[model samples]
Target chain A: MTTGSPGNNTPLIEARGLHTFYGDSHILHGIDITIHKSETVSLIGRNGMGKTTTLRTLIGLAPPRQGTIKVHGRDIKKSKVHKIVHQGIAYVPDDRGIFPNLSLYENLIMAARSGPNGRDDWPLSRVLDLFPRLKERMGHMGNQLSGGEQQMLTIGRALMTNPDLILLDEATEGLAPKLRKIIWAVIKQIKKAGIATVIVDKDIKTLLEISDRNIIIEKGKIIYDGDSEKLIKEPEILKKYVGV
Target chain B: MEFSFYLIQLLNGIQYGFLLFLVASGLTLVFGIMDVINLAHGSFYMIGAYLAFWLTGIFGSLFLGIVLAIPLAVALGFVVERLAIAYLYKKGHLHQVLLTYALILIFDEAQRFLWGNDSHGVDIPAALSGSITLTDIQVYPVYRLFVSFVCIVIGVGMFYVIQKTKLGMTIRAGASNRQMTQALGINIERLFTIVFSLGVGLAAFAGMIAAPIDSLYPGMGDNILIISLVVVVIGGIGSIKGAFVGAMIIGVSSIFGKTLFPSMASIVVYAMMAGILIWKPQGLFKSA
Candidate 1:
């Protein structure tokens, strides 16, 4: 029910009154989120604040106990994860989740798919252009890549699916400062390409710089959701909700 | 034993190893990709041999019987996966073990009821029925060599499919992480059914080939199930390369034990499995 961006008219993903649970333990209590097309939205919070859970729910890794998830205005709460990908949502978990036995090229090519409506927007050449290291280590196994390389590969792999939107959880949880800069640069390039993204990372300042809007979550509820300028203007909300 | 006799035994071991590879390839894939421990896999092999025998008798051609048998076995595999194996996917390994073990019993009884309780012989194809003279006192059967060659070709074919193709990529991804692969838009459920059927087909193919050598009997599967498990364990649970190396090691070691130490021959495969399991625990070819 909240609109963060006025100019962005199209809603790519909308979650209404989502109630998610892990076994008997309730994790998300009726949280709602709206991500418009070509927008970068950040979910910034302390650990275990339902950020990852929200992302998980959207992609059907963990289906919500109650409420609705709509992709492109269609109900997708009951859809499987693979079907959800066709709905234009791609998820990259915190662990990177690369297949260690697969080669670098295999990793990228395995998830290789045309964009929504069979649009050949993102291809191997374009992906390799963004991260040329993937090309150099094309024959290298996934486990052999450095942390930074793995992060790049994970993002690149998701893009191979030619998704309309990507969900990145802890995109730079563990990385060198140089690698962090590279990832933020990539995110910027992704934004320039007109793809929507939902990001979850701990670096609030840099995350604020890359994202169009911010949502502060506390104990599974959205305490504050607003533009970055408004978020920066209010320090008490950040401290109270996200401990920043 | 003379030098020619020793040479013949070595060939025999390699041939046995090849046959084991064919059976274990399916077992390992089912274990690796579908994440299911199919205890009834050996039943497919037994039934395949029986089917081969019945078909060869009816068609009166060994080659035709083999040609007709593969797709039928594959169909059987598909039907079995859809009916029973699909339900046990979410259950524990204990459940899988029990259910598939029960399946073994069912298949065993069904085969006996259908084919009767006597061991039946299958004639070797005419093309491979002759033997080459090795020494003044010894001659080697051509059929065993042909079996080894066929198995090697299949093994190589399996490698190409798993390592070099797009479907292989999906399978590897599925095997390593099921949730992530599904999230990547691969229809893993359909893939599982296909993989299960292929695995069964491979096991049954091994059965078809070995029918002439091993003959068809009720309890043939009981020992093979255990031995194939040994191969899967020895090669690392889910690796095809591991299965090949494990099969070769088993093939060579069993024959060596039989020739060198008659008392240890029967237990050699078990001993190797136990020792290797203790050492690597993940098997010989634990690749990334």
Candidate 2:
């Protein structure tokens, strides 16, 4: 386990003992996660292994039955989803929830707001510049966009909020190879811009390469949490837990 | 009928349609965005008329009464949304129906207790009391024309807000996915409250403005409620544009039916609704 390094005093998000449930079915079992500043963390697990639930819990979408979630040492377990997000966290859901009725410009502009302490680092122009394809299709409604374009719009919409940390669930789920390359490139740029990201994607190889740390979950519990280099050295652990 | 007679009926139909639009727009938006069936929505209209009557009596100026009545209506809407409609969001349509239906009864009783079970009339503001002669024998009240003009201005403003503004975009986003909207740092609870209140305010404003023409009476909201619901259904629930189109259709058909087929005038609007539903069951415009 990696403790806080010197000069990295406070983690961006610190979630402890998260036990979440969907209806009567228990999903997460005492899951603990920590996302440090400017660090890219990859969350890898097989389908329906509580991967999405963890992201949902941290963002307060699915408030855990028993857990404490804190952002910058401020307890947010009982806070509303929007209030938690106001703490400089943005969540891109697995379904890429774009407003189908709204135009692309409307979608991006609606989520536009300054980050915590009025930080306005990411403006509309900056976001559109990041995803040139979106700028080209500004007048089109969200439903008119292709799946790849929708994914880019979702990410661009998230960045419009100028969030400090982004929880990306299924960053590249259903996409062509060329689109996937574009999404991965954007992810790297987002990471380069110093936004801490907890990415959940099926591409284990690319995740292992791009992430600073890798945390593997199995049946709702953390099986491996360590350096990316160390996880790369242990191929047996990856094959056993994630089948990578 | 003479050509001038048909022209007068057409103008009246358009005027009535505009009034119905004011009521149905709120209903459709509430149903679309919040997914709540607010059966008591018409109660706001009733209260608006009653408020105009009571306030006009107090202030002695219909113009001042209307101006003051709007804020009161809006404030009442805000309170009702916060106290009653807010809780119905998570509940199913059955619960929403039952609760809102109960609210209708409560508002009815409250109206009777406060204003008494008597019909009252509000005089048109002196400025709008004059009539313009369309023909030597056919004269149209300026107030009715003013009502149409005001409704048009409000409608245009509403369109601009929904189509071009940030708040409008967020509302559409909320309708699309409430969870995702909240995740994006939007205070959806606040948004819902604003939308519900706006719906209430619009309905009440419709009632207040229509009070002079329709008069104030007990259970007046019930009739308008049913008609507005028909308008909403025809428009497609949750679509403002659809509501406007539906209201106009019903307005014109009902007016013409009254003139041409007096015996079956009541059924004309319903027949029109059925016919439209058969052709385009999803409504003229899909929900926004």
Per-candidate DockQ values are 0.67, 0.85
* lDDT agreement of model 2 with the native: 0.90
Q: On residues A1-244, what C-alpha lDDT tens digit does candidate 2 reach at each position?
A: 1111223567889899999999998999999999988889999999989999999999999999998888978899999999988888999989999988888998899999888878888889999899999988999998899999999999999998888789999999999999999999999999898888999999999998999999998999998999889998999998898876
Model 1 lDDT per residue over A20-121, tens place = 999998999999999898889999888988999999999999999899998888789998788889767888999998999899999999999866667667
Best by lDDT: 2
Give the residue spans of candidate 2 off by over 4 A: A1-8
Structural similarity to truth (TM-score) of each candidate: 0.96, 0.97
What lDDT would each prediction earn against the true structure? 0.88, 0.90
Candidate 2 docking category? high
Query: How many Å off is the CA of B142 in candidate 1?
Result: 0.8
**How would you encode candidate 1's per-residue C-alpha lDDT over B147-222 as one tens digit per residue?**
9999989988988999999898888888788899988888888989888988888888889999988878996888
Error of 2 at B129 (Å): 1.7
